[model samples]
Target: MKNSNTSDNKDMEMKYVMVIETSDYLHRLEANQLNLFTQKLHNGISKLLKKFDSQILKQDDNTYIVLFDSVTNAILCALKVKSNFKYITLKFDKSIRHLKIGIAHHTNRIAAQTLSTRMCEVVKNQIVITSEVKKAYEKENRNTFINKEHIRTLNFSEEQFLTNLMNCVETIWNNSDFSIVDFSKPLKYSKSQVYRKMISLTGKPPSSFIRDFRLNRAMHLMYDRKGNITEIAQQTGFKNPSYFSKCFKDKFGVTPKTYSKQHAN
Candidate 1:
């Protein structure tokens, strides 16, 4: 184990780590098969996180780094995805790896070193969290999956809804005054029906989708060199750059300043 953090700030600040690791299944696949399946696995989990108003921060090959909004919700999502993976893999003739995870709460104070590196190290060391989280997820799997209506009610697939949702998100991502009501207005469904349909289709409410969409777009703009953080935030519908930085840091585990520095290198 790495040195134990002795900082007093540990209790006051909340930090979390989520690791998505595949088991022995990866070793069996050919190169093409490995790339294809891994990409699909990443997209699958990425979509699930967006629905939960979270984002995958960084990824190392098959290991994904995600800063979940909360520990409980994160665990539930991991379990749901893990449970669904078996079903998804059935269609493929080639072998595919199974997804499992490690979750850890970092209470240590933010030091001068890189936050992302430390977060990854601690979580990797705590392999026990993977099994513990997996167990807890299984216990809730029945309610989480059995009751969910996997069938499409609107004669549309989740992928279709996600595509449409992204269109809406892109349209409104630059408008500061944009609201869920505004975002939903363009849908073919009724306004009242749009909310529930969106919730059912995406596993997230309209409001969360809108907000997360903006933040994500802002982050993209940052990495793309479209503009600096403040400009990117404002252009992506955030009026207050400070508030934008706070939200970005909370969801991504690093301030925009720090993130930009790392990416610039």
Candidate 2:
């Protein structure tokens, strides 16, 4: 146990690991083969991180934004191509071992050393966030999937995964207030099927996806309108301010109050 802990610590120190999985992609594949592609990607990342004895953090669904940082490993992970917008099945695989992450936090240096593993790279040549993630998801219009973001660059396999997962992200994004009973009735799929689909696409259950989506949407709402945190919470489907605050901090790395202070103009 001591050796295992030591090894884990070493992995955490030297390497930066990030894993994002989607269930909608899994839905498109056979039941027995859910997340195999993502598993391979995760395996590759784990292996790479192990070489550096890096620490790993896995975030499910469309929550990759939370893993952004300026370290070389973080920057390399951010550049990983998981899917494409136009093509749903072409996988573009690249080794991020040599990628150098550059951040503006320090003009004297190229990246942020203080944030060790929390930041991802800032690539001038890359457009990481796109409307395509939203559009591809809207096209599906299901209860279990939701559109999150579209990959600017992807190969065939990656495209396939994005097409399916983006749809799942959209499904969840549009129906943040939908109840489990409603989902079970309309889809006519078993509860397990519903759970598995969400798990495969978002690396989280359906409920967590909805909650995070609501929080993200609430953040947008709070940013755009004149309202208090309580109002934003209710508007985003939270019945209680306390729970909403907890979820907000868990997802965004800060309380709603802090987020408002940081972003409010």
Candidate 3:
């Protein structure tokens, strides 16, 4: 791979692209807080980029586009960022709580950008490298990249199914009375079919998927300071605050109340 500092170069040289997207939780912060949060995040990530000899190509709002000359450097930097993300967030008064990072390699910048965007949409709170990057990394290292879970290559139909399922879940996410039957109705699939497909695509059953969606929604609401824990729980379809806290803690390692307090202004 060759590095070109100028975009006008017509020569084809392989480059690794990394996309970093902060969670929507950051949107809830006030302007000054958001600026501080961005600064902290940028500083933390800048150190990683320097360590890996990469450079930031662009940054817009909560998203950053980074460039790496080597696949090995890109993979190592991404893994480091993913592992240290929580600690980086803790540096901010109003933390940017989650991230979705995608890495891809291609000779063309636009193609790499598209692949990275797709990978970001499919994964959450983690780093996902395209199969191309994964192949290059393993080949160059002469060893398997042990974190197979971080590599995802989704086909068109699987992507479409995930999009449809997410839309369906969004439509009825707040309905505490929502059931598997209700969930399957809008997807135009039989309950059994939906269950099997959900497991196949997401490695989670329908009920677990629904619960995770609700918990994620609850976290967004908490960051938005939309309501108290009880109101937020009920709004996200949890029948009670205690159960909501239990589930939230189980997934996030922190109760909703504690999370809210930690991110409070």
Clashes of each: 0, 42, 0
Candidate 1 C-alpha lDDT tens digits along 1-265 = 7446743333333345566666224423445666777787778877887776554556754667666545557656756776767766777543333444555444432320123222222212212233333344446564642122321112224334444655576566688887667756676666667677666644457766566667656666665578998888888888999989998877555688886765563
Q: Kindly list the per-residue Cα lDDT of model 2 for residues 1-265, writing each as its tens digit.
A: 3675885454334322232333223322332343455455445544544543334333342222122222333333444433222122345223211122211122212122322111122111222322332233334444533222422323334334334444444565545367655444555557677667556534567577567667756876765665899988877778889998998877655688886665455
**Which ranking of candidates, highest TM-score first?**
3, 1, 2
Worst 10 residues of 1 by lDDT: 146-155
For model 2, how many clashes?
A: 42
Off by over 4 Å in 1: 1-160
Clash pairs detected, candidate 3: none
- The candidate maximizing TM-score is 3
Per-model C-alpha lDDT, please? 0.56, 0.44, 0.74
For candidate 3, the lDDT comes to 0.74
Candidate 3, residue 74: the lDDT equals 86
List the candidate 3 regions with Cα displacement exceeding 4 Å: 1-41, 47-100, 103-126, 129-150
Query: Cα lDDT for residue 198, model 1?
Result: 65
True-structure lDDT of candidate 2: 0.44
